[model samples]
Target: MTGTVTCEPGTPGVPGTVGTSGTPGAPGTPVVRRNRRATRPAPAGVDPRPSQHALTSRASEDRPEGWGDASASKQVSSYDAELQRDKPPHWG
Candidate 1:
């Protein structure tokens, strides 16, 4: 004769089968509980401008005036004897 297996609470049994006296939906699905903090609005009369414009304007001002100018040449001389011998014609 074939016998059926029964499991009590806190005992090991087949997966998805809840033991007797255990809560419904206990074995199949997990219970999720979340603790969330309440968000508060910012205080009144505080200026938020420093964070917005501080980096952008300062970075633009810090750049040299010659950075994007085509006429400003970094090369001191085109015919330096040492550079002419070492470098290719296309690089000069």
Candidate 2:
């Protein structure tokens, strides 16, 4: 016979091996894993995550007084902040 060498067909790649889109992994159904974290009770009379609408009067309650309306996106700098305490003289 003439010199013609033909090898077996190459094995097919996994489903999601090529291209720019589609799910991660082998391109099949997704598998959801379980979360091992355990929930615990917080402070008393405080509903950390209130389920009812009346629980939180306004979602922006944590925001500063002037940080409302169009000014919400502006960067805020506090000039009279008191939480910072004076450090002891050592590296001076």
Worst 10 residues of 1 by lDDT: 1-10
Each prediction's number of clashing residue pairs: 0, 0
Best by lDDT: 1
Task: Determine the C-alpha RMSD for candidate 2 after optimal superposition of all C-alphas.
Answer: 18.1
User: In candidate 1, what are the lDDT values of residues 12-85, reduced to their tens digit?
Assistant: 54443453335523433342334555876657886545566554353443556436422354544655657658
Alpha-carbon runs more than 4 Å astray in model 2: 1-36, 53-56, 60-92
lDDT, model 2, position 70: 34
Residue 35 miss distance in model 2 (angstroms): 7.5
TM-score of 2: 0.22
Error of 2 at 61 (Å): 4.7
| Structural similarity to truth (TM-score) of each candidate | 0.22, 0.22
Worst 10 residues of 2 by lDDT: 2-11
Candidate 2 displacement at residue 45 in angstroms: 4.4
